[model samples]
Every structure is written in structure tokens, then in C-alpha cells.
Target: MSTTAPRQATTPTSTGWSLGDIAVRRVDEIELPRQTGPWLLPDATKEVLDEASWLRPDFADADVPRLASHGFAVTAGGLRIVVDTGIGNGKTRANPAWHGLDTDFLARLAAAGFPPESVDLVITTHLHTDHVGWNTRLAGEDWVPTFSDARYLTSRTEWDHWAAADLDEARRQMFRDSVHPVRDAGQYDRVDVPEQGREVAPGVFLVPAPGHTPGQVAVELRGSDRRALITGDSIHHPVQLSHPHVHSCVDLDPAQAVRTRARLLDTLADTDTLLLGTHFPRPTAGTVRRENGRYRLLAEHGSEIAATAA
Candidate 1:
């Protein structure tokens, strides 16, 4: 991996913003693999994890920030509608794969043209550390909201689950660094989707895709005839695109996660939709096409690893 990341993907439009009024910018940060060290696949996940073993070597190096393409939509006048912030610097989660980590997810936000003050809405699909890291920054002795003027929106169920205090050390640590500070600063607002999954923004809505987290959700974006869905940790890798039955090691309810995945896959297959994933490698935005009940990632431009190599 290169020590430096390539520039954020770009396109030209004299309008001076990206993709018309909805400008998306990638924030640099990484969410370490939750599982590391010698670990056998859970009997249930064997087939799913093994299905794409040949591609695992492509992500072996830790030098390049494995950013989940932390990004958001920007208005023509520069108002920021942040989707999710990436892992923060100096967080202390107990999972060995995520321990001993540090990165500048905020600086990248600035580089992407979103000053801390420009953010309007900070939306999170769920309450995982990676989905909410930039929610707060280390300020002197306490963690505080990185965006002073922004409202941090989260699912009501997710907020309640992590704050329950019965979670193990790793989960407790995740909550401490990724969530509590935003609430303490009076910046966090828990939004209830009584229907379980519902729209949270004009063009964005939450789909109750549970099981990964008790309240795991997917954000859907619609504009004119175009539509996109952000599958937050609901499906971790593109490999899962073809094998929706594979369970994420972090899901609160593995069985539920599978059902959500199946539902999502069904939706993708049945509709002409694009997807933006929190962890679907680089250029995370793309279209999904179904072939014999299987799916493949149809990148917006093309594959990155191949272009970078050439």
C-alpha cells in the first residue's frame, strides 16, 4: 500500500459542485477488521467467508487507510449533509483488529472542503464506532462534537442498546469513543422511525435492516429517477453481495442479519438501484446487478485495483 492516498475521485461540471447539487466527498479513515489473529470461521459463516478467499490478499497491508469512503452530500451553496464519519484518532476498542489505531479522519474532511463548521446534518445508519467516529473529536480532556453547528442523527434503538451498560468491554469502549460524547455535548438527537425503517431526510430514508445491530438501518437516497442505498455495515464486503447469508461477526442477532441481507439482496435484484456502502472497498458507490440470484458490484467508473496497477 502507498503511504499516501490518491486524491478523492472527482468529475468536472462548470457548476463547481460534484454531481449537480449533491456533492459527495470521501473522508479518509479506517475501520480495522473486527476479527484478526488465528480464528476459525464460525460454522455458519464458512461458505460465505470462503467464497471470496482469493480476494483477501488484496487488502492485507495496513499502511493505506482502509477508509470506508467516509463521505457526505454537499449542497451547491456548500451546506454539508454528512452521511457517516469514519474512525477517530486514539480510540480504544478491545478488538485486537481495531486496537492500536490512529488516523486523521477529520483532516480529510477538511481536505474534502467540509470545514467543521459547514456541516448541517450528521446522519448515522447505526451506532457502530466506524459509522460515528468523527462525531466527536478529542478536545483537551473530553471528546466533543466535531461539528459545532450540526445535529447528529441516529436510530433510537441503536442509542438505547449501547447505553444499556451490559455490553462487554469492547462494546463499552466503542460506545465511549464513538457515541457518548455527541450526546454529552447536546448534539446527538435520537430519531424514532416508528415504522422501524423510514425516511430521515428529503432524499434519504432508513430501511429497517436489522440483525447486524438490533436497530441496524439502511439509508436510501432518491433524486428524480435516480436512487441509491447506503448499506451500513449491513453487508461488509462485496463478496457478501453474492452470499447474503454470511453473518457479520459483529451482528447483535446473526439470524436477523441474514434475514436483512436476504431482504436487501432481494430489493437490489428486483429494482434498478445503486448502492453506497460504508465498507465496500474504494469507490464504494455503484450499481448492483443480479445474475441467477447472485450479485456483482458494477462500479461507477470501473475497478480501482486494476486502474492503480495499470
Candidate 2:
């Protein structure tokens, strides 16, 4: 494996982390407060937020908890791999916040040195609206694959579930525009990974982490002596690190989500594995620590062994 020097923590901004020679960066789309009622963790009321004092200002405020929609760019093994394309421009979404998003997401990706055509692989951890929106972009009159030279990878089970799901017209439109276009272009690859994990690239693999979505998987990167996991909605906020049972409102199976969260946390606790949360706000990358029989996210602050940059 290739080797890289360690860097410092710089969050909110476009931060990048390195595992050996593999570089992972976050491309921002939008970061805003989401309602706690029927949106985030329904049980995460003022009382719960107050109890989790560490979530203040960054992840949550006095009112509601906040989450971000962004894409992660991983460069390794002579390939530029992007995970979870955030909400794209000019799309009709069921949620008003996500509708017709005309953000500088593409420009930001280019600024990070990975343009659309430069991408080699695009992986959507699950078929969520926010996760797959940028899979395609609006052309003169039709949606086309945004990464013209890349192969888009979607979980086989996720594709089948969303295709047959009893979704409304708005969600169906999502599949038609963002998903089908790539498949039609023969630029799509369906991945069926085992629970133990499936290696997709030189030092990268997919770890089965279901229940947030039935086929949700976490992307794992391993170097010679360092490791990290890109948690794709499996644990939405850091509060879930303290309270793994707090399921998000968007979870397809709340009970199963809790189990998966607990299992993932347990497996990573006290290990060297760096935890990179997809929706986590500033200082998004961290490590899990078992504290007093509970798990806590130890945010990277230029002190941890792992290095992050933008």
C-alpha cells in the first residue's frame, strides 16, 4: 500500500482524510437544521438534546438538530471514487428543502481536483433521495449521467427495493431521472456484498450495514496500518454515538437500525478505525471510544493518529 503523511483536523470546510495513499474528501452541498419531530430522531426532544451536551452548536442548536447533504470523494488505487452524490440541481423532491437545489456542488467537486469526468467509480450506499441525486445532471431536455467516464455502483438489493417500493410519484421521478439514465447508458454496476464485507478496490471495501435502508452499506478503507469507515446514514449524528438506539425518522426499520448501529459501534470501539459520518457536521471524522460502557465519538483534533484535509 502507498503511504501518506498525517495532517490536522479542519471541518465544516472541505476536509480530507488520508489512509495511507488513499485520500478521502467531503464535498459540501447544504447544511441546515432539520426538525426533530418526525424528521430526525423523533424522540430527540429538547430533553434529549440537553442530555447530549456535546451536540450543541455544531450538530444541534437550541431548536433543532442539523444535518448536511454532501458527497465524499475517495482517491486511491489510480481511481477517483465518489460515495453518495448529494442532492443535485433542478430536481423535484418530496421535501421542499431538497427541491430544485441549484447549489455549486459540481464546482466544489472540481475545486477539490476531481471533476465529473475524472471520477472512476460512483457508489450510492443506499437509494435515498439525497444519496443518489447527483448521479445524473439535467441536460437540454433529458437527464444524463454526470460522471460520463465512471461506473455507478448501487447495491443490488437497494435497486430492487426502490424499484418495487410503493413510492409516490415524486420518488418514482427520482429513480427515473437520477437512476435509470445511468443504467440505460450501461454505466451502472450492481454490487451484492456479504456481511463480512466485499473488496471493491485496492484497499477499499463495502461493509454491510442495513436497516437505515434495507441495503445500506458502509464504505471501509484500509491502509497498511490505518483504517476508516464512511458511515452512510447508518448513524446520522454523533448523538447516536452516545445513544445508539435513537433511530432516525427516515429509517426503514427502526429496530433493525438500532441493532446495526450497536453492532458497528461495538466492532469499532477502542479500535484504530476512524469513523467518518456522512451527515455529521463540522469535525465530521472521528474514532469510537467505549466510555463507561457507552460509546462516544472522539472527534479528530490534530491529536488522533488519522489525518484529515480538504
Q: Report RMSD for candidate 1.
A: 6.8
State the lDDT of candidate 1 residue by residue for 87-183, as single tens digits.
5566775544344455655555555556688778888878776677677777797877888999888888877877774877776777777777777
What tens digits encode model 2's per-residue C-alpha lDDT throughout 203-225?
98998889988888999988666
**TM, every model:** 0.77, 0.90
Give the number of the best model, judged by lDDT.
2
| lDDT value, residue 171 of candidate 1 | 69
Candidate 2: pairs in clash: 16-309
Residue 129 local lDDT, model 1: 66
lDDT of 1 at 198: 72
Best by TM-score: 2
